[model samples]
Target: MVTGLTLNLFDFQEKAVMQLLDLTTDSRCKQTIVVKSPTGSGKTIILIGFVDEYLNKVNSNTAIVWLCPGKGDLEEQSRQKMMKVAPHRTTQNLFDALRNGFPSESTTFINWELVTKKGNTAIKDSERKNLYDRIAEAHRSGMDFIVIIDEEHSNNTAKAKDIIDHFSAKNIIRVSATAVENKRYEFYEIDELDVIDEGLITKALYVNEGIEDNVEITDDYEYLLDLADAKRKAIAARYQEVLPEGKVIRPLALIQFPNGQPETIRAVERKLESMGYTYDNGMVSIWMSEDKRDLPENLTENDAQPVFLLMKQAISTGWDCPRAKILVKLREGMSEQFEIQTIGRIRRMPEAKHYDDDLLDFCSVYTFDEKYKAGLLATMDKAYETRRLFLKPKCKTFTLEKEYRDLDFDGLGEREVLNRIYDALVEKYHLTSDKQRNRMILAGNGYVIGDEILGQALHGVFVRTDMVAEATSYYGTRKRVDTHKHGMQLLHSTDAIKTAIGLSTGKVKTILERLFRKGGNPKKKLLALNTAEFYAFVINNEHLLRDEFRKITSGMSQQLGLTLEPKKGVFHIPEQDFFKYDPGVKEEIEYLSNAYQEYTSGYATSLVRSISEQLFEQYCESRDDIEWVYKNGDTGQQYFSIVYLDALRHQWLFYADYIVMKKDGTVWVIETKGGESKGKDKNIDPQIENKFNAFKSYAAKHGLHWGFVRDKDNRLYINNTEFAIDMADDHWKPISLVF
Candidate 1:
C-alpha cells in the first residue's frame, strides 16, 4: 500500500498512466510500450501510478526493475520518488535485489552503468553469482519481471541492448521525450500542445536573432557570456515584480560548458568573478565531473539560492529544478548539432504556472555559435510539428484609432438602479431583518449567515427533528406528516421562541403563528427563496447600497459567486492583441516562405496581421447591420476547401479564409493579402486568380459576397474582379461597399 504522500496528477498525467497500464496488461499487447511524453510532464509520477495500478490487478507479488541512465544521483532520485509513492515496498539496487532472491513487490532502480559495462566484465564472479545468476533463476522460477527504461534514447546502445536481452523479462516499457524508433515497440505520444495549454510548462522558446552577426566578428565566448548575464538580470527583475507574497524564488541561469577541463573551469570562474557572481558572494555554484557543490538548502524559505549554475553536460538529464529558466551554451568542444535533452533542463515553470509578465513566462537560450543555433532551429522544426524556435520581439505596441472610446452609462441614475435591484432581491429572498426567519431562509437556500449563528440554528433544528421523529416513530406511514406538523408547532412554543429570538413567550408565539398561517406550508415557502439570484442582485447594486448591503452579505458574498461584472456601458478596448505574438505561443507561421520572406522588415508583416484583425473588430462594433464576425482560425468549421470548376475548366479547391455575416442575410468571404508588391501588381498571380474564380463560383451559387483585402496597403477588391476600391484610409468603408 502507498501512503504518507498526496499525488495530484494533472488530467494529462492521469490519461497517460491509464493508457500505459492498458498497453501493459492486454493479452495480445506488445511486450514493449513507448511513452513519448515531453519534459516536465511528470514522467516519474506516471511511473509510480503505473506500478500502483499494475499491483492491484495481479494476485501475486511482481518485481519491477527501473533502469535509469546515469550514475549515483539519478539512481538516488529515482529511489526517493518511488519511496514516496510506495514506502512499504522495498527499493534497492540490483545487488540487494539479487541477494534477496528478487524480492516480490519490490522495485530496484539500477544505473545503466551497472548492467552496460563492457563484455559484462564489470561484475565479478562472486557478485555475478548473486546478481546475474539470481535474476536468471527468478525468471526460470516463473516470477514476473517488468523492466522500465528511463531516458531510453540516451541508453539505447549495444551494451544496453545486451542488458535487456539478458533479463528476458515478461514486459518492457521505454519512456522518454525523444524515443528511438523500433518496430517491435508500440508507440504512444502525449500531445505537447495539451501540456502547454495546461500551463504545466513554459509556452515558447526565445532565441537571439542577431547572434549570427555577433559571432562572426567578436570573441564568441565572451560575447555569449555577456548576453547570458543580461538575460539573467532581466529574468530576475521580472521575477521580483510578480513574486507572490511569502514565496522566495531565485531565478537561475544554467551555463553549459563542453567539458570539465581545468583551464575551462578556471576561465568560467574568472568570468563569474568579474561579473560579481562568485561562490563566496553567494551567486554561483558548480556541478562538474570532479567536484559537486550542493545547491543552497531551504530554497523555498530563503533567497540564498545561487543565481548561476556552471556545469558540463552531466546535468542535461535527470536534473529537476524549476528555477532554471535561462540556458547558455558556449559551444567550445561540443558538437554543432542540437539535442532536445539539453533544452529540457530549463523548460519547467518554477511554480507550475507562468508569471503575468511576458518576459518571465518564457525560457531563453543564448548561444553565439551560428551553426549551433541553426541546428537547434532544425531540431525544433522536426521535434515539434509547430515551429517554436524563433526570435520574438522584446516588446509589442499597438496603435489605437481615436474613434475607439468608452461607452457612457452615467444617464442611468444610481437610485433608479438600486430600487430595481432591491425589488428583485425582495421578490426572491423575502427581505427581512428577523434573525430566526432569515436563518431558516439562508439554510434552505444554501447560504450561511455566520458559523456561530448557523451552528445555533442547526442545533435547534436537530433537537426539534429528534423530538418529532421520536414522538412519531410509531406512526409508520404518517411519520413524515406528523414530523412536519410537530416541528412547526414547536417553533411557536415558549421555550423554542426564547431559544431562537430571546423574545417574550406570548410575543414570539404570536409572531411565529402569523408568519406560518393555517393553510401555508412553511417548508414550501422557504424552498421558493433563491439565494444565488438574491446574492447576485445585492452584489450588482452594492455601489448604490454601499455599507448597508456589505453589512447584510458580510462573510458570504465571495462564496455566492456574485462578482459584479465590469460596468457594461464603459467599454475599454485593449491596446494590444489578445493573442499576442509571443515566441511561446504554439501556433506557427512560415516566415521564411516566399510569401513572407520578401518582407524583410522583421515583425512588420506580423504587425500588419494584428492590425488587420483589429480593424475588422472595430468595423464590426461600429455598424448596426453587422451581426457576427469571425477570424479564420476561430472555428475549424468556418472555412471549407472545396473542389470547384475554374474559368480554365479545371477542377480546383478554394481555400477560404475569414467570414463576415450581416443582419440582412448576407455572408462575405474576405481573403487578406500581405506585401506591397502583391497589392501593387497589376496582373494577379495564377494561384490568386484560381482562388478568386472559385470563390466567385461558390458565392454566386450560395448568394454571398466575395471580397479581397490587401492588408499591406489596406485596400479592398470586391466582387471577384481586378477593379479595386481604395478604402485604405477608412476600414469602415467596407461595410457600405460590401452591403
Candidate 2:
C-alpha cells in the first residue's frame, strides 16, 4: 500500500515491508527486532520501502538512523540505494546532521568508526561537539529515532554497543544474513528458497563442477583460470541468445590470490596476457591496496568493459557486481578461511531474472583447495533459518522489579581512560619531558626500555626456471639471524602494537605517539622521544606496555585520582516478551497448562537438559500449593535483574532462573547451579558467591524470600545463607522443606 515509490517490489518484498511496519508500530514497549535474510535477497530495497511507508503512514515526528560497519563503505552504498529507490524522501549523512540538526522524516547514515575510533576528530575532546550538539538539537525538536544496525553480526563490539546506547533511540532493528537467535528480539526471516523462486538470485552454486573427484592437487593455477574463463564465455553467449541485438551482457570472471605472493601474481599476469586478456587492451583490472588499474565507473553493470578482475583479498561487503558469474581462488600452500560474503559476489542474477539455461542459471567456482571448499560449505549450512514466536497474553500481569543504568551518568570514554593511564604512568615512573631521564627512570622501575633495533634475515639459494623464478632451501638458521647495532629496523611496529593490545592500529599509534612524541604541547607531553627512538622503545616493550594499559583500563590501578561509580536505576519487566529458534532444527519445548500460557513454543529444547531446572519445573507443576512459575531470561533489558558488585568493586547484573508464586501469597526467587561431590567441587561459574550474596541482600530488603538450588544424583538441595559447594555441608538442606 506504499504510494509514490518508483521501484516495483516483488510479492515477498512487499510482504516483508508490511511485516516490518506492523512490528515497529505495535503497542508493546519492546525496543529491538531482527530481520534475517540471505545475501542477495534485496534486503536494502526492502528496508527502503519500509521507511517510505512509515514516514507516510505514521504521524509522529520521527527520524531514521542507518548504522553501517566501517568496512566496505557500506554507509555510502546504503545512502545511494535509498535515493535511487525512493527519490522523494530526505536523506543525509553525519556531516549533514551536524551542520543542520536532524530534520523530521529524514534518514541519516553513519559509519561506526567515525564515532567509536579513539582520537577520531568526529568525537574527540579536542574537536567541536558536533555529534552531541546534533543529538540534543534533535531532542529539542521532539524527534524519535528508529535505529537500524545493518550487518548486525559484524558490529557487536563493545564500542559499537556504546555508540548505539549514546543515541538513546526509541526503537532498534538489526538486519543480517547470519543473525543468531536471542530471546530479547522479535525475529523475522526471508526464506532463501523464496528468493531463488523469485529469480532474484542464482538457482545453485556449483563447486569444482566438471572436474574429476579422484584427481590430484596441482600447483598449476592455469587450469582453474582456464575453466573459469570458459564458463564465463559460455554464460555470455547464453545472454546474447536471450537479449535483443541492441542490448548486450558480458559476464565477468573474478580471480583471487593469496597475500604476499608477488611471484605467483607475476606468473598469473603473464598467463592471462597469453590468453588475450591484458591490461594494455583494457580487458583486465586489478584491485589491491597499493595498485589499482582500469576499473570502470560502475562495475555492476552488465556492459562494463573488464572481463577479468584480480584481487589479493576478498571484496568489500557491499560490492555488488551482478555480471560476475565465475570465481577462481588460487591458493599458495597455506589454508585460508573463506568468507561467506566472497561467495555471495557471484550469486546475483544479471537481469534479476533467471533464464532456463543451466549454464546461465548456476554460478561456477573452480578452486582446487579442498580446505577452502570445506570451510565454505560449513558456513553455507547455517544460512538464515528463523521462526517467530508470539508473546502469551496471560503473562501480561506478571511483573517484577529490575535494575538499569542511569543515562544521566555516561561512564568513562576511551579518551578519559587514556588520560588516566598517562597520568598514572607519569606519576609512578617519574616521567619527564627529557627522553634520556625518562628512559633511565623507567629502566629503574623494571621497564624494558632498550634502545637496540633487532631483526632477522633469511639466507637462501636462488633458483630460476622458464616458467617461474624463486628462492629455495634456506640455511644457517641461527647464524643468519644476527643482531646489529643500528642497521636493522622494525617495519610494522604499529601492527605489532595493535596485536599486543588488541586494538585498532590507528588507536594504538595514537596512544603511543600522543603520549611520548618529541614536540607536542610541552605541558601535555610525558616523554620526548623522536621517531626512531619511539619506535624502538615501543617494539621492544610492547608486552609490558600492553599489561600497563590493561591494568588501568580494567580498574586495577586506583591511585590515578579517578573514582569509578556505575550509574544505576530501577528496571521493571516488560508486559510482553518473545522467543526465537531455528525451525529447520527439531528443537522445541512444549509445556501444558503453564502459568504464562497454555504451552511454550520455540523454547530451545536440548538433548541434555539442566538437572536443576528439569527437577524444579516438575516439582512446581506437581505441587498443588504452587500457584504459578514464571521463567526468567538470562540477559536483556526486558528481563528481571538485580544489581551486584563483583570482586573488583564493579557493578554487574544477576538474572535468576525462576520466579515462583505460592497460593499462600508468598514469592520465591531461585538460582540454579551444578552441585558438588565430596571429593571434588564441580561448580564452574566464577561469580557464584557474589551472585548468591547479592540475591540474599536484595530479597531481604524487598520483603521476598530467595534460595540457591542445586542438583545431585537426581535429588535437589536448597541453601539460603553460607553457600558451600560440597553437598555434605550443613548449609544445604532438602528442597522439600523450602517447597
Q: Would you estimate the TM-scores of all the predictions?
A: 0.48, 0.53
Candidate 1: tens digits of C-alpha lDDT, residues 1-739:
1332234577787788778878877888888787777788888888887777677665246788899976436777888988886676678887687568677777888888766665565566677656777788777777788888887655655556656767787788888776534444677777766676677677766654124321232233455578777887888777677777766677788888766667666777887898888888778888777776755664322265688888886666788777887777765431233344666777787878866566776777665322322111211112211111221231112111111112231212333323333444456668564536755764566553221100000001111111211221111011111222233223323343233222345543333233322333442222232333322222222223333222222111121222212111221122222222323223343333111122122222343244454444445556777654444432222223443322212233344555665677576667654324444543333345445554565567667686665534454333455433333434324434764
Candidate 1 residues lying further than 4 Å off, grouped into runs, are 1-7, 118-122, 209-217, 293-304, 333-335, 370-739
Clashes of each: 1, 1
Q: Which portions of model 2 show Cα errors greater than 4 Å?
A: 1-7, 118-123, 126-129, 258-261, 312-316, 369-739
Steric clash pairs (candidate 1): 204-584
For model 2, how does the per-residue alpha-carbon lDDT over 399-464 read when each residue is reduced to its tens digit?
666665433432444465457667878876877767678868887876544343322211221111
lDDT of 1 at 396: 15
Best by lDDT: 2
TM-score of decoy 1? 0.48
Question: By TM-score, who's the top model here?
Answer: 2
Local accuracy by lDDT, each model: 0.53, 0.67
